[model samples]
Target: MAGALDALWSQYTWALGNGDPRTDSWLLVHSPIPVTLLFVCYLLLVVAGPAVMRCREPLRLVGPLAAYNLGLVVLSGYIFYEMASVCWWCLFSKAIELLDTVFFVLRKKQEQITFLHVYHHSTMLFNWWAGVKFVPGGQAFFVGMLNALVHVFMYLYYGLACLGPRVRCHLWWKRHLTTLQLGQFVAIAVHSSYNLFAECPFPDGFNMAVLLYSLSLILLFLNFYYQTYLKGKQDKLT
Candidate 1:
């Protein structure tokens, strides 16, 4: 069965083929275009979403936001499951995830695309590109799987939050969501750093570009969690 599936998938490689890996294909995958373009779109979202908050209405943002998060939840789950079977699945799934940013752009709901959102989305894309493009299968597959597990609940909560005024009192999982996301980044960073260094003694040559990218994501996520959650708590206490 696996052999037949491999044969079928091989025949369809052209349809799924992305980078060349021979002539600078590696460079192209790690290029800044995807990240820069996504950042610009995200900035516009943050700036514009609040401006139009009055007209757009929080409830109006609920449906699409819910759907988007829910889709990601499922996507993360599938990717994680496939990775467990054939670790390389993380790379394929991450590359496909670049489209999520497009959804954020189209929705014009910048509020949904928070700093954590942008950081997570952008890093995941580049990290996977790095993985598939260079690092084939190492600790990466595990990290990606862990992330997908968390997304299932994260998106569900976000979907509920989108409902606004009619939102159930217990629907608010924002605090826990942020906490989980932070932990996810920290774990990725630690595991990845171990693989990168000889400290953990994992195989080398998986791809340095993405290793760096994942590390940066950890730093940014830590900062974001500190500012968004910790600071918020401090203000509340004050």
Candidate 2:
């Protein structure tokens, strides 16, 4: 058992390398077990963390939450600019971004930690792992750039909201955040679909995965928008 595990680890680690000695260090993250374990823990937390807090009061992690969001804003920006140029840096940044849900779990904001949220965060780890392993450059980097731009604005909004009721007045467009997310998915789907016909060097499998994934997010987020915003507004009027 131990030998088999060691062999698996070695294979995944070696495969993560891009044949560049300068960045071979970053390939250490490709250890399949650790990455799988991390996501498994995250999934368990998504299921049990909220239930554990069910009887408890919601936590007010005002300062920590603000810092977390701001950190992501910076990290996303870094990934946006360096994704194609420095694949490891962007991959590392995205690995850190997965921690956002940990904040939600800690704050007992389980309601905010919806399935879509968990699914998105958790899957990105694996998806980006494949990306870093296979097609880590070229037009493949566009999605990360778009996602980073959106996250910069999104996290900036969350950071402001964490400041307290004083900032609520400026946050009138909270609903628009979801709209922006939907727009992002639409853009990703369109962006990915272009590869189907265009002569891009990126792999067909990865492009198909991106297109299908974006389409799924579009449908899911659209449902969330309707139920949370549109339907709620109608309920209030009637």
Candidate 3:
């Protein structure tokens, strides 16, 4: 067993060594161990956090929530600006986004933690891990750039929502946010699909993975949109 484990570790290290040298020394990209552990901890928190909060009152986090969302808005904008130079920040943003789930659990907003929410948050880290590891730039940067831009507006909307009822009432573009997200996914799918037929320097496998992932998100978001907007409107009318 010990010898087998040693060989497995050696093979993992060899694979890591073959990844992009530019990102090899960057944080969380040196080895899969750190990111894997982080992912596991996130899952554990998702499972355990609600239980811990079950007995406690939902903490009112008005101030902190506002700050957090606005901060992310700034960070997302900055990532968009700097995406051309660095890709690791995009990967790191995925880890930061786990905080969204944490906030949901703290507020006892269990309904907000849907399968699409958790799956999108959790899987992005690993997918971008492979992205940042092997194909750090190229076609992948387009997806990151577009995502960061969308997040800037997304977080801004959430931050404004935390201001008060007055501010939220004025925020009439809520449904449009989902529309924007769907648009982003569509744009990414088209961009990634283009690479599939073209002679791109980036890996075809990565493009295909992204194309498929974007399609999955489109379906999931469409379901969410229908349930949240269309069905709710119809129910109200009846």
Candidate 2 Cα lDDT to native: 0.78
By the lDDT metric, which is better: model 2 or model 3? 3
Query: What is the per-residue lDDT of model 1 for residues 130-221, given as tens digits with 9 covering 90 to 100?
Result: 45544445555667677777777776776676566677577757778877876876676666666676654344554344456556766776
> Per-candidate TM vs. native?
0.61, 0.85, 0.93
How many clashes does each candidate structure show, in the order listed?
Answer: 2, 0, 0
lDDT of 1: 0.60
Which residue ranges in model 1 land beyond 4 Å of their true spot? 1-63, 85-116, 196-215, 236-238
Error of 1 at 100 (Å): 5.6
Which tens-of-lDDT digit does each residue in 81-106 have in candidate 3?
98977689888889998999999999
The number of residue pairs in model 3 that clash at the backbone is: 0
Quote the positional error of residue 65 for candidate 1 in Å: 3.6
What lDDT does each candidate get? 0.60, 0.78, 0.91
Best by the TM-score measure = 3
Cα error, residue 220 of model 3, in Å, equals: 0.5
Summing lDDT over every window of 10 consecutive residues in candidate 3, give the lowest-scoring window.
Answer: 84-93
